[model samples]
Target: MSTGLAELHEKARAALDPVHYDYYAGGVGDEVVLAENEAAFRRLALLPRVLRGTPTRDLAVDLPGGRLDLPVLIAPTAFHRLAHPEGEVATARAAAAARTVLVSGMASTVAIADVVTAARSVDRDASVWFQLYLQPDEDVTACLVERAERAGCTALVVTADSPVFGRHRRDAEHGFHDLPSGLAAENMRDLPGGPPGGVRDIVMSPSVSWEHLDRLREATALPLWLKGVLHPRDAELAVGHGVAGIVVSNHGG
Candidate 1:
């Protein structure tokens, strides 16, 4: 019998085309960092102690704004359509059923509003976080934050690991520059004027800075979080910026 995660992985592998699978699954250069990420988790040994009249296990965790029934949260990843036809909607439903959190990525094919609807369908009070790509324009970033707020997102996750796109040999080999025609980056589409180039070009917002954090705070009342922070100093800086939380990640390096 296969486990739920195993079944999900197999289904995703089968549903997505080979090139798309590699693009979503592959990493930069030699992929040593990717290997290390999984290896590091496996190296840690879980030390479970004998129960001392503990009736049940409690997985709940209290976050800055609310309580999470399960400490586990779905990390943001681009282009959920590659995983299943329902895209982020399906993932959000599953997360809600598990009584966990879902962090929707900026590159998600499903609109933020749709994801929010799905989450609400499962649990009216479900926790959903929106992850931003920091579009090439400051105004675009601001608009995304506002839209997420309208969608009832509880947190804002700014992914700052990618200053410039990394060299992904798999994507380069397959010429995978943009999301497939039917799919789109909804956050980018919500901006006032269209991005500098047509949708295919990866827009890099050169304006990302500490000052941008202030702009983000001004944009919405939702708690802010900075993902992709690996350094202790950067984590400190995020706190100084009045962010509520920090995710210690390197973006699979």
Candidate 2:
């Protein structure tokens, strides 16, 4: 059996298809950020004190929507079906069993309703947040948000910085764009009052600004959390919009 994440990653690389494996394993150009992520862990100095506490401890933490089983949360990543056959549905079920929150990606392979149903099948208190990708059309964005609400999502996580997708050399080399059959982004495939052919062609508004946040705030009652913030100035802007929280990141910058 795999003893740690490193071992698990190796096993997954051997088990998963090359297209999916590359997508998950590869980072942006030069992968400096990935290197830094590992270096940051190495830089941490653990200071264990004598008689501080017992081995057992409470891991729960209160989030905006509710209490999380642990302080950790699963980041929103696309195409869960690439990793498992059940896709985001299986992820939702696992999150329910763990009593933690799972932020379902907007580009999830499973439908939002199906993910919610899977989580509900295990526990009523399952906390699922929606990672929303705002489109150029307010109507389209609102429709997505409304569907999340109907599907019992507790919060809305807007990926504020990924207005444009980054170029990944690994993905290009592996020809991931060709896409295998049955791997479409199901959440984008269906939206309330949305047009046909899904949103694969939709470009995120490069003009997205604070005013857009105001419009998005009006669109949903769920607590809004902005992800992909890089600078303190941007964090201030998010706070000005009255966002519930800000996830500070440059998205592999």
Candidate 3:
């Protein structure tokens, strides 16, 4: 029997071209961490409990200042148009229907405001978080945080991974650095004169640093979180920097 996740994977594979799928699924270096990410989950085997006297089970979880009917949260992905024409809007609607939070990717094709609107269309009180990619320019990064707050995003997720672009040999083999013109990086384009250089320079944000985290916190009132942290010391440092949360990720590793 196919699980819901398996069905979605099949659908995604069928709907997306090989290049797009590889771009979304591929990871940096040897992809050891990427494989470990799935392997780690499988390591834990759930031990089912015996039947108990219960009429119903409540799945609702109270988070920060909001309540989630489900424990699931949507992970951010770039160029969602590669998966479906509706892009992040479609995923946002699905997340809202499930009463789960949706994290909007910094490289999303749909504008942040539009994604928030899509969530509101499904659930008036949808919980939405905006993922941030630290840009080379401090001003640009600050502006993005401001825009996300204005869009009513509940939190700011600073993706600390991919300071530089990862080398995905699969994408390189197929000359897949380019995305379709209409599906450009919306959030990143909010930069003053737009991103520097040509298409290959997509992930070339060189000026991001720990100090910028302090600047980011000062720039917005939204709770800040550091994603892509793998080391315990990094997690402690994030806590020291006044970060509300830390996402332990290895960038598809």
Candidate 4:
């Protein structure tokens, strides 16, 4: 039986450690965005339709390259190992079972290849996508994208909003941002750290400009979809750049 999202969330909260639960549920500082998220939903009214008896309910979505079993697709969330032992590998398997898309985050605990392999093992035709956090150096970003292509990622979902990490007070109270020892973002294993003994930053490029997407296009053949776009003007700019698609998001609201 399928549990409601709210129920699942409460169960997860009850199961995890306090610090980890904060990491899972907390958003950026003050959480005004977080509180208002559900508030926006409460204002919406859905009218019930009269019974036009039909058992078949199609939820598929057609796109440029292929079709999704459902319009829903998983977003790129980092560090799945903190919740499950299989990490993104388990997520890929679940996506395969549901015949949909799983956009594995660049900062996932498991290697990108392992996640892809796990999905294909579960279902040979699973469509696995990869998420990218653009690096400071263009060459580095190129290498990462190429590696993802080689790993059999069907598409690339590039994160656009998180040039810098958000400050979450709930996690901060738990010392989640203190830069503890041995806490590495797995995909960033060999990449440059800010300083030898200093805090290990996310290594994303804050100065990544509009033209960078064109350069990214020139780097790989995989379809690119930019995520975390909220502004209308930026959406128009993304269309100009010839993106495959745009995912409207507020990062974590």
Reference-based lDDT, each prediction:
0.82, 0.82, 0.81, 0.79
What's every prediction's RMSD, in angstroms?
Answer: 2.5, 2.2, 2.8, 3.1
> What pairs collide in candidate 1?
136-205
Q: Candidate 3's residue-wise lDDT over 64-137, tens digit each? A: 52568977688778888888899999999998999989999888888899999999999999988999887776
Candidate 4 local lDDT, 1-253, one digit each (tens): 5478678878888887778888878878889998887688678776767786988878788765346899877888888877777779899999988888889888787778888899899888778888887777766577568778888888888889987777889887887764234544656555443444332345666898778888897778888899989999999999899889999888776
TM-score, every prediction: 0.90, 0.91, 0.89, 0.88
Model 1 lDDT per residue over 62-97, tens place: 786456898778999888886678989999999888
Q: What is the lDDT of residue 123 in candidate 1?
A: 94
Task: Name the lDDT value of residue 151 in candidate 3.
Answer: 92
Clashes of each: 1, 0, 3, 0
lDDT of 1 at 20: 88
lDDT of 1 at 40: 88
What is the C-alpha lDDT profile of model 2 across 196-224, one tens digit per residue? 76545445768777788888988778899
